[model samples]
Target chain A: MTRRSGTAVLVAWLTLVWVGLWGSVTAANVLGGLAVALVLVRVLRPSPAGAPAVVSPPALLRFVLRFLVDLVVSSLQVARLAVGRRVELRSGIVSVQVPGASDTLLTVLADAITLTPGTLTVEVDASTATLYVHALDVGEGPEGVQRLRASLREQARAVVRAMGTAEARSHPTPLGRTGDRRREGQP
Target chain B: MRDVLSAVLMLTGVALALVAALGLVRFPDVFSRMHAATKPSTLGLLLITVGAAVRMREGGDAVALLLVAAFQFVTGPVAAHMIGRAAYRSGAGAQAGLVVDELADVSAPPA
Candidate 1:
């Protein structure tokens, strides 16, 4: 993968944020923003270790479109559930394994899931690369959990596809634990 | 036309904020409460900021409003995630009506 221009991108984004906060785009503001962004980037840059993931613009666009749709649909779902006469929610924590993803991508995926209405990411087991997600509906039995797991797998796959490199996508990892199948039958 | 649009946006934003408040009171558990707190509030804030920018129509004001909205979008999820993690660790998920506790193994030692 090509080396990421992290510094340039960070500086530009910070400058935009700076201008937005100041509510002005004058030369003085822009210059001050550049100075601040430069300092911030120096302070906040991640250690140079693993190569950064190259984001595919097309995949990123698709991810954004799908996320918007999910956002609206889930918001309405939660709103209805909240205001419904009988609020019957079968919530469960489901562990999803997102293999080969960088720390940044995993955090992004977790944030995206939490931002969605019905699901909140409760924990990220960095050791195992597992995300513990609390879903609003896990159905009646194992089947429900399985279904949710499948959907979460799809979400994780979408994220990896959108942002991961060609190598990371090829060696795809199993999304959930096989042992979960047994526990699914219990509750 | 601008005034009408701004009025509509502001009213909708206020309504969303009201719904978010209702959810905060109505939802049973911390996780669900978080669902209420983040999504609708973020959307409401965005709508209100957009409305304010439209009403002001000044370059600086508009830019500032947009920046506020952007910051909210970025920080809202991060804050929600941290709160959710804290709740999960504290056994808040054990509240009645919670169906499954997959993180039981992870949280057991903490409590």
Candidate 2:
């Protein structure tokens, strides 16, 4: 969406919230909401870096459905682990490489990862766009790290597909997935 | 039937929150404890909000309840990320279970 439209949406959402809070949407309430929302939007504008959040409805549906499934499955896993006895935990921190990902995509990806039980995003290196995620269980050693990282990178790709601009979508995200394809010369 | 369903959902949400606390106590380190605390708790909150909305049955109340849930969903991860980053930086959660520390090479320390 363009900057102007995004601001309009923000204002509209804020106005809705105000009306909802007021319960009965009177003229006074709506006017008050509009004034407050306009002021808030003007005061706290988001950075230009995430200017284009041109979301695809289908891709977003795909991401949201997959995310909900992950949330349910992972929450259950954690719940079971809590109730059940466990011997040794093979938890580890794996750094996922998602270079040039926009801030909005990163935020969405990190939020999804954290909401999922198996993985939590510890740190996001914005310069390189790397996400350092801590997994609840990733088997063991280097291979485990690689596997989790790859999966999380897949999530990042999904976010891109859902929310990325046309240029951002054309990034090397799908062209040559890391380590999977080795027939041609690997980067 | 609606009330019964609402009760079930609310009870399940409460149970999940308990599970979150259990994991927080039992988990080995900071990161793991956070994993336990965050995921289930967020889901539990969602469940509780939905249950309440269903039972309330008023448009205004339902909207408010859902808005609370939405706010929680947006803010929860941000809080966890800050804590996680801080713990990792301070070397707080680097215990024996950590098999891979790939971040050590990249983020040295914020100067």
lDDT of 1 at A162: 84
* Per-residue C-alpha lDDT of model 1 across residues A1-187, encoded as one tens digit per residue: 3445756777889898887778877899899999999898788874532446767789889988888777766666666766777567888888777766677778778878876757888788766667888887788997888778778878877887788755557653634345253343523
For this target, which candidate reaches the highest TM-score against the unseen true structure? 2
Give the C-alpha miss distance for residue B107 in model 2, angstroms.
Answer: 2.8
TM-scores for the candidates: 0.89, 0.91
Clashing pairs in 1: none
| lDDT over C-alpha atoms for residue A134 of model 2 | 87
Cα misplacement distance, residue B37 of candidate 1 (Å): 1.3
CA lDDT, every prediction?
0.76, 0.81
Per-residue accuracy of model 1 over B47-93 as CA lDDT, tens digit each: 89999889895888887887788889888888888888888777665
Estimate the overall C-alpha local distance difference test score of candidate 1: 0.76
| Residues A45-162, model 2: lDDT tens digits | 7555654777888999999999989888888999998889875788777767555567877888899999875999999877756678888888866677667767887787788888
Report the C-alpha displacement of residue A137, candidate 1, in angstroms.
1.7
